[model samples]
Target: MNDHDAAGPSPSPEHHPDGVPKFDRRMLESLVCPRTQQVLIYDADAQELISRAAHLAYPIRNGIPVMLVDEAREID
Candidate 1:
């Protein structure tokens, strides 16, 4: 067995099969909703930054927040 095989693979940033890179969880701390001017909460399960006040979910594309209202999903 080779050293590389024994050491195994190292941890890398998580991403989707589509190649969308996952952003840092700490990024949530400074994000705000453009419409409501309110802080966002990271929804790791859905890969979105949710703005409860605006009732919208902004997508995290390639590890960056697409904060545009047009791109955001309206919540019920």
Candidate 2:
């Protein structure tokens, strides 16, 4: 068998080698701000889930979203 067949398919860009499932963009369709129940914008550069309506920036750590209001940082 070929090496490709033995090692299996390569991981997608959204997946990490550490076995953590990267935050799927599709999640934006379902996930909402706890404070305002508004749609969130994914900031790939900052790795944050931005809630414009709530004026808060929720951090994404290790491919997991920390959605708690207490964990979020206030923004302008």
Assess the local accuracy of residue 21 in candidate 2 as a C-alpha lDDT between 0 and 100.
59
Once superposed on the true structure, which residue ranges of model 1 sit more than 4 Å away at CA? 1-19
TM-scores of the models, in the order given: 0.71, 0.72
Per residue, candidate 1 scores C-alpha lDDT tens digits across 1-76 of 9999999899888886878788888877777899999999998768889999999999987788899999999997
* Error at 6, model 1, angstroms: 26
Q: Model 2, which residues run further than 4 Å from truth?
A: 1-21
| Worst window of 10 by summed lDDT in candidate 1 | 14-23
Evaluate all candidate structures by whole-model CA lDDT and list the values in order.
0.88, 0.88
Tens digit of per-residue lDDT, candidate 2, span 41-64: 999777799999999999988788
What's the lDDT of the predicted structure labeled candidate 1?
Answer: 0.88
